[model samples]
Target: MKNKFLLLTWLLAVPLLWGGCDKPLFKTDEASIAQPDELPPITTTGEGTFACKINGVNWQRCGGGFLQSSIIGEWHPVYKIFSLQGLRSCEGFDDAVYINAFIDSIGLYPLEAGQYDDFNLECQDVLDQYFLLETADNWVEILNLNTDEFIVSGTFQCTLVHEGCGDTLFITDGRFDYDWAN
Candidate 1:
């Protein structure tokens, strides 16, 4: 009899317990804004040295100081028949940068010549796709590789197209030194 009474009491309270809250079940407000971080999804893998310069004096890479790790690695842009981005097959002084993927579907080789390419196209493809250079493209130089390898003292060139302004080619043809990460 006690168990039956207890069961009866529990059953009767369930409806009363859930009755008060009736705020249209659930809803989302599209107009109400969210945080900047909540606005658009920021890429996790979309990290790398995205450097740019209008003239050549002020050069900047992505990640700045806080997010610099993404851009710190041995990377080079190459042009095969089909064009392929290649990463250094050999590991750099720093082991943190891993060659996850290469950019080209087939390896880097001329369709007619069939000559072997130096760097692996697979690695370069991944970098190009991840770090897309949609603006007027230019030869990308491998500035520094870890603490040891650095580019030969030369200023690389780049092309830029400001949104409203047209296109501009930047020439760093002179010579420049690279400062490797300590």
Candidate 2:
């Protein structure tokens, strides 16, 4: 009778032990920078001397950054195209999607511990809300995964409901290119 009780206790404890622990994390592998010879063709459309402005003031250049990624297996230029919907100048935006341009200031954030895959980028809006965009999604399809430049050509709109300002929509369209700064 004692043996039966002990066996029952052990069986219950075994499951609890297994279920309580989180999954073990794995390290991501590293990818090398693509050689100039193997580098993918860069899109010449909208290239050279591009600029942007926010609230009628000149802002930073749209593209000119680089990121290193093991997944991409090369030093990829952080370039992509994005489209915006429902945006207007001097209007309070509430519910709209906008195509916001972005540049990869830093290399991709690691999906694993200490792994830097150039597939991730830190993007922000005119308001400076940080959006950590990743290339693992459909972005890989829009931008040539083999080249440092990829294009994200789609309509994105944002609908914002500001309590004080009511609501507004913002949208834009453009291409982004990236270069290594540091």
Candidate 3:
């Protein structure tokens, strides 16, 4: 009888001894960046929308209260190429994407990773972590090229594997609109 009463008391007292968790705790593996539904639209007016999803997570280029974000590009008429880069800066991430042009037409081009000096799509996330094009599908297609205004607009998608690491990043719905200088 006494043991039964002691067990009941212990169970009742244990509930009171435990503290409450008012704050939310997240694990390192589960700590993913916040995602927003509204991404910048695809435009040819140099809106500079450098955004994509990383492993199904949102990645955007913006002035993250600290570092500034911008898009810089150039087109060489004689070389028949247009190159552009997206510099992204956000809280806890400084990402960048690069696309080097080869053809001067508004068409789809092969952008394979790990290849040397042709049409390529490359990205860097969290430093030393690069997008590998050899793993999955990757390409870039120019939708609009306004030579008069020097605006280059394109859409790109790639499956990037981490160099030296086994992690993968899916860069999807990627688009860019930048005013290039010759």
Per-candidate TM equals 0.23, 0.21, 0.66
Worst 10 residues of 1 by lDDT: 91-100
**lDDT on C-alpha atoms for all candidate structures:** 0.28, 0.26, 0.63
lDDT tens digits, residues 1-182, model 3?
Answer: 99999999999987565535443343222236556776678787766666666567666676543245666667687887666666655544445666665757799976633211111123323445455566476777888888888878888787666554555667788788877753
Q: What is candidate 1's lDDT per residue for 30-103, written digit by digit as tens?
A: 22422122112212122222222324432332122433222332223352112111122221111111111222
Off by over 4 Å in 2: 1-141, 145-161, 180-182
lDDT of 1 at 132: 16
Greater-TM-score candidate between 2 and 3: 3
lDDT for position 16 in model 3 = 67
**lDDT of model 2 at position 100:** 34
Regions more than 4 Å wrong, model 1: 1-53, 60-64, 68-137, 140-155, 167-182
Better of 1 and 2 by lDDT: 1
Error of 1 at 24 (Å): 44
Clashes by residue pair, model 1:
48-71, 49-71, 85-124, 86-124, 102-122, 102-123, 103-122, 103-125, 103-126
Q: Ten-residue segment with the worst summed lDDT in candidate 2?
A: 112-121
